[model samples]
Target: MSTTRPQLPDDRPEQGGSGVDDGAGPAAAVGRRTRRLTLVGASGVVPMARDFAREALREWGWTPAEGADRKAAAEDVLLVVSELVTNACLHAEGPEEVLVSTDGKTLRIEVSDLGSGEPAPRTPHRAGRPGGHGMFIVQRLSIDWGVLRVPGVPGKRVWAEVAAPA
Candidate 1:
């Protein structure tokens, strides 16, 4: 599959964890950046998702910082991306596009696919199972996440929002 990172709006603030202030502004109220990726198929979508997230994090200043928060944020982003993309690849035909956006305080991830079935976290919590923890992980890590059906469209968009590093 092909992965592409388009240029986001320049007005959005860049999220850097150094807290050294690169003159971007206060981290609390930083602007937003949204990156969209169009995937051709399921093959290698996991790595593609990770790469897309990594590039966005670097651009947003999620580099290694003094505190663990920065690292945690980066890891969370990667994990969330992997989980969501993997879910799409496994359950649906494949992901059509993945959108990752951040407003310094929170990171929002959305995976759109050509599937109508809604994704739900498995009930009863099968921790010992070979799999089925993807949505569970997404639920635990994200502040909020859910599936959205596009009006008059054939597919749905699964999305999650996680708090950025402190």
Candidate 2:
């Protein structure tokens, strides 16, 4: 199988940087569009998937004013990705896809699996269970999250968005 890094938009302007014209048009006013990074499957590619997300954040121009904030954000993104991917791999069947995107203020992570099963978040008191804590952690960390049911597809997409640190 081919391992390819997804393409990111080249002309998307930075929001707070100088030389960025506010009157550049509606599209430019929106600033840089979030790029999608996809991983075909969870097996054997988890580490690479995490690294890809971190690199994408850097490439999208999210730099920390001080030490390690950028790294922390990247790590947070990676952890969320790992949790979603692991849940899909463990509970679902067939190929899986992971997509990560950022819109300057928030980072969105999505994992698609071929299995039709929906992951329900268990209550905190029941969190001591051997498994089933993935969605719970996701709920606690993400600003908002949900599932998307794609017609004609055997499975669904579970997505989460975390607010970007100031």
Candidate topping lDDT: 1
Clashing pairs in 2: none
Q: Model 2 — TM-score against the truth?
A: 0.69
For model 1, residues 1-166, the per-residue Cα lDDT tens digits are 1112222233242332321232335433446566777786446888988898788888788865448877887888799899999898889988878877777778888787888777878888789988889888888888878776646768877888888777
- Give the distance in Å from residue 57's predicted Cα in candidate 2 to where it truly belongs: 1.8
Minimal lDDT window, size 10, model 1: 1-10
Candidate 2 residues 27-112, lDDT tens each? 43455344344445335656765666666666666643245766666667778877887787788763256655665788877676
What are the lDDT scores of the predictions, listed in order?
A: 0.73, 0.61
TM-score of each: 0.79, 0.69
Model 1 lDDT vs. the true structure? 0.73
Clashes of each: 0, 0
RMSD of 2: 9.9
